[model samples]
Target chain A: MEWRAAVRVTLKPGVLDPQGKAVQGALHAQGFRTVSEVRVGKYIQLALTAESRREAEEAVERMCRALLANPVLEQFAIRVWPAEQGEEETP
Target chain B: MEWRAAVRVTLKPGVLDPQGKAVQGALHAQGFRTVSEVRVGKYIQLALTAESRREAEEAVERMCRALLANPVLEQFAIRVWPAEQGEEETP
Candidate 1:
């Protein structure tokens, strides 16, 4: 089954994302005032075909382990979607 | 309307993700030998109610600009989904 995988990797909240905080300050400088928060993170879009949901999760976990994420300071969430649905669905 | 948002930011390739590379090496050292890539990042699950899809995106973009990402080194994408769809849709 060809699926869409969204892999999010972010720094642990208490770890101090100065980069994120700095960007937050910059946005305030830019005048986009409605911004309530600014925490920087990574999103990986993968193109894969799996036989089952389990297989896809395992594949994404593998990708995270190899090229998609770091486990020590960051955490991730994996959602597998069937290729048929567009942005209208949520996991 | 309540919706879901996914944010992704990655270090520019070749910018030296030593942290990510180190974790990749560690995964290799472990027994999960099939992992092909592991890069490390953040996932923020937001529960927001918006008037429209555009509003939701603007909200997340605001979040990214201020606290979620560093414009100097990162980028992001926003997708909005209705609360009715479960985890089976693709964006």
Candidate 2:
């Protein structure tokens, strides 16, 4: 079966996120006055063949640890499910 | 009240994503031969003050339109919820 996966990689706590801080400042300057903080991360979507949901999840987790995310500075959450016909349009 | 929001930005269908293709090739080379495709996107986390969930959602949508995402080549989904005590640690 083909499975679709999404991995969200975010900076760990206490990490200095200059990109996030710069975005926050930009938002404030643009009149989003209530925005207090912003954090930026990466979202990766994958399509793969797997025998089962569990297998897909494990593969995705391994991908995260190996290449999708940097464990020292980042943490990742993964979501996996069977792929739908038109799901590829949106990722 | 303080609200937490996540914005997921993905490439629009039919858009050329060399980065995605590169990652897919890398993954396949690493022995993940079953992998068919990959897509890359951005995930943004925000902390802000809002009167209600609706307000928070609106602000986030506006942010996506104005700065966080490029509508011509990308689409974005927004998730808003109340801020939890330690939620910032992961985003």
Best-performing candidate as measured by lDDT: 2
Interface DockQ per candidate: 0.17, 0.56
Give candidate 2's error at residue B67 in angstroms: 0.4
Q: Residue by residue across B23-80, what tens digits does model 2's lDDT show?
A: 9998888888888989999999899999999999999999999999999999998878
A82: Cα error in model 2, Å: 0.4
After TM-score superposition, the amount by which residue A88's alpha carbon in candidate 2 deviates from its true location, in angstroms, is 9.8
Model 1 stretches with alpha carbons more than 4 Å out: A33-36, A86-91, B1-91
What are the lDDT figures for the candidates, one per model? 0.60, 0.87
Residue B70 displacement in candidate 1 (angstroms): 13
RMSDs, each prediction? Answer: 6.6, 2.6
Docking quality of model 2: it rates as medium
lDDT of 1 at A61: 81
